[model samples]
Target: MDLNSGAGSLDQFEGGDATVRGAAVVSTRLSQPTDEWFLEPLSEIRIGATEFSEPDQKLFSVTQFVTAAGRKFSVPYAVATRPARGRRLWRAKVPAAAASS
Candidate 1:
């Protein structure tokens, strides 16, 4: 299913059977408005413990711009932080292609 296509889009396949072993799932309609689109980060991200060593610091950032129902929403630098890093280390900016297909 296309994640970008919102809700009712999957209604068409509601009564379909799982007979086909390798058939692709198809949706009837898109959940979101056609005009509405997502502007996601097409680049790499990098976050290390050094960047969040301080008690209060920006750990990560995100930018998103989408238009829905004739209204526009812009999110710039959605910053987040935590008191301290846990044993589970995290890394950002890793090439997505390298990690997954």
Candidate 2:
């Protein structure tokens, strides 16, 4: 699920499976379009949309960066966009943890 920069260009990340074993979970925030926040060595992400954030007050739209072994890591923007803003991303972690939650 690619992130929307909100400026009609896609900050694309390939969709990844959450249930895969040993998947790496990463926490990320949406930055302004000018801030090309690239994940080094991680050959993933696409582009679309843009928005500007205030310098003093940084807004973090947190989301799950899920990736299983031998696959590309991705930012789950669909879940990340629930509130359309702010830090609202959550991962159930493991099945047992999900059940407990």
Candidate 3:
């Protein structure tokens, strides 16, 4: 998905497979949107949504990044809003060993 910078301009990324395989999740909280965060490579992203009284709604997109050294960073962005913010949505990650198969 292409992530744009701003407020309330996020494209709808909901209503599909619970988990988006090979998704590019972006982070809008950095000094600049870099490939490591914006162009998230080899990441499995999950999309979620919730309604909070009328027009107020929030959508979540979560992904984890693993570096060559094995460091992991779980990044979750509120994709419902432009300039996506970070919000934790309920989810569990299957261990790499178990997911390999």
**Candidate number with greatest lDDT:** 3
Model 2 lDDT, residue 32, Cα: 40
TM-score of every candidate: 0.16, 0.19, 0.24
Off by over 4 Å in 1: 1-35, 49-101
Which candidate order results from sorting by TM-score in descending order?
3, 2, 1
Ranking by lDDT: 3, 2, 1
Clashes of 1: 5
Judging by lDDT, tell me the better candidate of 1 and 3.
3
- Give the poorly placed runs of model 3, Cα more than 4 Å off: 3-20, 28-48, 53-96, 99-101
Instruction: Go through the candidates in order and give each one's C-alpha lDDT.
Output: 0.30, 0.31, 0.38
**C-alpha displacement of 44 in model 1, angstroms?**
1.3
The better-scoring model by lDDT among 2 and 3 is: 3
Tens digits of per-residue lDDT for model 3, 9-100: 22243443453334333455577545545433432322232222235354434443443234455434444444333332223456799899
Judging by TM-score, tell me the better candidate of 1 and 2: 2
What TM-score does candidate 1 get on C-alpha atoms?
0.16
